[model samples]
Target chain A: MSGTSMTTRAWLLLLPLLAVMVAVIGWPLADTVGLSFTDAKLVGTAGNFVGIDNYVKTISGSNFQRSLITTAEFAIISVFAEMVLGVLAALLLNQQFYGRTVLRGLMILPWALPTVVNATLWRLIYNPEYGALNAALTQIGLLDAYRSWLGEPGTALASLIVADCWKNFPLVALIALAALQAVPRDITAASLVDGAGPFSRFRFVILPYLAGPLMVALVLRTIEAFKVFDIIWVMTRGGPANSTRTLSILVYQEAFSFQRAGSGASLALIVTLLVAVLAAAYAALVRKTAGSNA
Target chain B: MSALEIENIRKTYGAIETLKGIDISLDSGEFLVLLGSSGCGKSTLLNIIAGLAEASGGDVRIGGRSVLGVHPKDRDIAMVFQSYALYPNLSVRRNIGFGLEMRGVPTAEREKAVLETAKLLQIENLLDRKPGQLSGGQRQRVAIGRALVRKPQVFLFDEPLSNLDAKLRMEMRTELKRLHQMLGTTIVYVTHDQIEAMTLATRIAVMRNGRIEQLGTPEEVYDHPATLYVAGFVGSPPMNVLDGVATGEGLRLDGSDRLIALPVHFKNAVPSGKRVKIGIRPEALRLVEDDDRQPALKVAVEVVELTGPELVVTGRVGGQRVTACLPPRTKLAVGTTQAFAFDDDALHLFDAETELAFGR
Candidate 1:
């Protein structure tokens, strides 16, 4: 075939996907960008041109600032904890032992559950009165009495982070376990003969193989944690003076709860920009690690 | 004292025994090779000697001390694996010095030793590269540098050259022999290649079914194989065995009624009508004229292959296939009968029942 005809045929084959993308994603994104420049209200007139008024208000607001910090804290702490716990679990499961296959199968239960179901389950366990956590802590004499786990401003976000890690860490473990299996047996044996103790072997020999895959896991979990919503919404509804309100929750309040469509669009776009920046930084880091490892 | 001694070592995996009872002792500066086909426990025995695998029973000693329960690092041994297990993340310099670093050697000292080892292997230029960036031959050199930098009491090689191409394998084989001569360290090497076994070993231990079939110097094992198995395994174009019955005057082959004269020494050794299997190497048989007086077999030629300087001819001799290596210029037609002569000393007789050589 001639080059021109081949190019025309390629474009023809891609036409259907392009149509669907414009209809589904491209149109809405353009509409949101237009709305962000106006003072539009939900279910009302297309208001007058504000010319960056929504963006100025959303950026300068204390709500956006506080929520950004909360999101950062949640993402950094939860992703770090998940990575450490996941790798430890993967290393333990990689050993030769009885019922290891069964344990590995069971490890995925929390991650497999629906997000809403997992959130509800954790809420019951952390119930302010007569919950399993309170009963166990009191029985062990570690708690003087039952305390509100999800109802206090200081403990609510910490409790939510614990719940998030429990539900998501298994995904990291599964990925790390697969990479661990790819490590050659000969290299480990070589390390043993090289006078490496268990700690040294893990650090120098095994960690190099795990670094690339775990970096991928870190990027994925961090993005997901920064955008966290459904679990906290179901468990706490951003209550206890909005201490656990993340960026997504604030966007929800602005757009749906307060009926401020224009500012909500602007805030949502800001969150998207922040996430894109984070993802790009992580991508550059992942490339550096992969290059060195190779 | 022997530099390494393996005392009646045995290993079992559940109900399957991989190494039944292996005992080998090597003096300092000797190169011992464990040679066998795959699944024959040659690698298992090397692992036991290196302390990479535990023996289910018996003991291993290095430098006159029992190291049965000792860790691999404490056993004063180093091994080069077939996979060239250099750490993929480390540069060639760190890969060679990793053992020393793990032992808490000073960085300057480790760097000096690694440089010396790299210089000896002619891989000094590759120290900054990772194993992934290296060619197979360079990776092999790095693997050897890792083992050599340790200066342990014994070195174990588990088919380290088998992963290379044929030309590279031959080159590395020569390099290994030269290294052994220079270093004079006790070594235990494992390989199934007969040519490598013949060229590199001071002594070769032929193994089968988790037991040593034959262990001796290369010449001794080649010239006088203790069992029928060793005889067939030790040579290329392997030794041919023919079934025949001993008569009062001569020996009668099973498929032919004619009797061929037995060597004079074997005439009294075998009683009349005794069954025996005769083994003859391909090189031992030569093309002879019809009126020659030496004991000979009349073979009908089937195929002739010219391998550069020699011709490998395969033919039928009384219902048995026999191969002979003859000079390249020899002219012989397919389907024509020819007489192949043999010397008296080249005859190897094995009992049909026991399969053991008549005179050990």
Candidate 2:
């Protein structure tokens, strides 16, 4: 076929996918950017376009600043906890043992469950009056009486963090486990003959293999934690004085409940920019590590 | 004291025994090669000595100290693997220095040692690069460098040069011999390649079915193999065997009705009327025209292989395929009948029952 004909054929083949992408992503993204500058409200008439006003108001508000910090804190703590636990689990599971295959299969359950289902599950488990956690703690004498886990500002955010970590840490484990299998067995044996102890061997030898995949996992988990909504919405609805509210939850409230589409759109764009930066860092890490591993 | 000693080493995996009672001792600075084919347990023996694998029953000693319970790292030995196994992420410098750094060697001292080793191996130009960036030969040298930096009591090489191409394998074989001479370290090398065994070993332990068939100098093993298996395994184109029966006078061929006499009396051998296998080296046979000799046998030529500098010919005598190494210029054609004579004293008689050489 001629070059023009070939180009036309290629474009035609891509039409369905391109159309879906435009309808779902491109239109909404462009409309969000355009609507952020207008004074759109839930009940009032549409006001005239006010450039930079929504952004300035949102940036100056104490609520927005608090939510930003909350998102940062949640991402930092939860991603770190997941990374450590996931790597430990992966290392333990990588070795040969009885029931290893069964254990590995079961380990994916937390990650395999849908996000909304996981949130509902945790909500039932954390119910103050009848939850298993409180009953078990009381039976073990660690608690003299049952107390609400998500009803207090001090413990509510931490409870949410624990729930998020339990639900998502397996992602890191899967990536890390695959990378561990590709580590050269001879190199590990060589390290043993080279006089390295177990901890030192893990630090110097095995860690390099896991670093790239771990970074990718970290970027994904961080972005997810930053825009976290479902678990809080289902379990606590960002309650207890807005202590567990994150950027996405705040955006949802501003857009739908309080009827400020412009402020919500501005905040959503900021969140997207932050996630993009994290993704770029992940790409760089993959490049730097991929070059050395080969 | 011997540099290394292995006593009654045995390895059994489930119902199968891979190594059955191996014993070897090496004097300090001796280069010993364990020669065998795959599944012959040469590599397993090396790993047992290196403390990388545990033996079912054995005692291993290096420099007069037992190392059975000691970890591989504390056993005072270094190994060069067949796969090179250089850490893919570390630079060449770090790869060489890692062992020392792990043992708490200061950074400056480790750097100095690494540089000295790189200089000795002529890999100084590639110090900053990772192993993935190096060629096969370069990686082989780096693997050797990783072992050399330790200067341990013994060096265990598990077919270290097998991964290289033929030309590089030959070059590295020579370089290994030179390194052994210069360093004067106790070395145990394993390889299935007989040529590598013949060229590099101070003493060879030829193994078959997890047991050493013979242990001797290269010349001894090459000139006189101990068992029928060794005889068939050591030489390329292999030593030829023909059936024979002892006679009143000497020995009579089973077929072709040829008679040959021995220079010595059968003093210790079972007296006449015994069946035996007669073994002869290919180089011991020579083509002769008719009426040239009394002990020559006539045969139909089957195949001719003219390798440079020498020629190998195969002939059928009494339904047995016998190979002879002749001069490259020797003229012979397939399907032609020719007379070939063995050297007067080159005949080896093996007892059919034991498959060992007959008593002299």
Candidate 3:
């Protein structure tokens, strides 16, 4: 068969999926970009053309700027925390033990729980009066008092990060565990015989093997964390003075709470653009790694 | 004290015993090969010696010091794995130096060691390249270089050349033999390839079903296999064993009335009317002319394979199939009836009941 005909056949096979993508994803995204260039509001019946106004305001606005910084900080800190904790969990779970299978199954529970449910559960745990965390702190005499965890501005963002990491770290752990399994037991044994201690074995052998998978996990979690809204919304709703207002929550506030439809569309579009950039970078990195390994 | 001593070593995975009691004591600079088929516990034995796996029973000592509870790193051994197991991210130089760095060798010293070993392996030009950039043979040299830089008390090899192609494996085998001669280090090698074990080992320990079948010099094992299993397992094309009966005149082929004369070594030991199995190496059987047939058997040739310097011919005598190795120029074809004789002096007679070699 000719190359053109083969290409045509491949396109024909992909037609149905392409139609679904166009209808589900392409249409909404195009509509959001179009809507962003107009003066549309939730209360209005018609929109007036106002080019670049939404984008300009979204960039210049302090709330949007702060939300962007907060999102970046949240993503970096939480992903780093998850990577460290996930690797530790993977190492512990990789060993042979009597109840290891049971423990591994239990580790997936936190990741499997719905994000909304996890957010609500953590919110309850961080309750001011009758929270488990405060009670434990008081019992252990570590806190000097049962201070409000989620209610206080100083602790809320950090608390949310802890909750996000707890709910999300198992995903990282699963990836790291798969990578760790691929690492030959013999290399680790070789390292041990070469007088490498536990830390050295991890640093020299295990870390190099984990590098590719860890980068993938980092990118994926960063994208997810940048767009995080449901968990934060359920927990603090961008609480006291907008401390925990990430890009996703800021978009929601602009479009729904403040009823600035065009501006909200613009903010959402920017967040989409950021996520796309990360996804592209990750794909390029993975391709390079695969090529070298090949 | 020996350089390495393993006494009553055993390994069990839950209830399934993978390695039965194994005892080995080796002087410094000697090379030992654990020869076995897959699942015969050769790799497990290597791991146990490296302290990668704990022995369920008995003790392991390296350099005259007990290492029963020591970690693999503290055991003072360096290992080369079958898969090479090179760190994909690191350059060959870094990989070679990684061991030294882990052992707290100074950076300059580690660099010097890596360069010296690289030059020795002729991988100095490939030092800047990662394992992914190299060929199978290069990666193998780097793996060996990595182990060499450690300068450990003992070197462990777990079928290191098994991953290479047949041609490369042969070359690496020769290179490894040369390397051992140069290093003069105590080495414990594991391989399922009997040929590799035969060529490389100063002493071969043949294992079967988690137990050592026989331990001897390669020549001794080849010349005097201890058991029927060993006889069948070792040697290329394998030693052919046939069942027969000792009659009044000579040993009679089973189901045939012909009595074959016994060689001088077995003449005194042969008893009348006793059943026995006789083993003969393929090389010991020879084709003869019809007039020269003294104790010859007539058979139809089944297959004739010309392998460069020799012709491996398979033929049927009575009901049993027999093989003979002849000169390369020997003209024999399938379906041709040919007369062949077994060298009586080279014949191995075994007691059928106990599967032990009977004659002197």
Best by lDDT: 1
Model 2 Cα lDDT, one tens digit per residue, B1-360 = 899999999999998898999889999999999999999999999999988889999899999999997999999999999999888778999999888988999999999999999998899999999998999999999999999998999999999988899999999999899999999989999999888998999989998888999988898888778887777777877888888887777767777677777537344575688887888888888888777445666778999999998899988887878899999999998999998887756777877778887655
Q: List the residue pairs that clash in candidate 2.
A: none
TM-score of each: 0.96, 0.91, 0.94
- Per-residue lDDT of model 3, residues B157-215, tens digit only: 99999999999999999999999999998899999898999899988899988898888
- What is the docking quality class of candidate 1? high
Ranking, DockQ, top scorer first: 1, 3, 2
Q: Model 1, B193: alpha-carbon shift in Å?
A: 0.8
Measured on C-alpha atoms, candidate 1 has an lDDT of 0.92
The predicted structure with the larger DockQ, 2 or 3, is: 3
Identify the candidate with maximal TM-score: 1
**Ten contiguous residues with the weakest lDDT in model 3 chain A:** A187-196
lDDT of 2 by residue, A118-171 (tens): 888877788899988899999999999888998888888888899898988888
Q: Show what share of the native A-B interface contacts model 3 retains.
A: 0.80
Give DockQ: model 2.
0.67
Better of 1 and 3 by lDDT: 1
lDDT of 1 by residue, B105-127 (tens): 99999999999999999999999
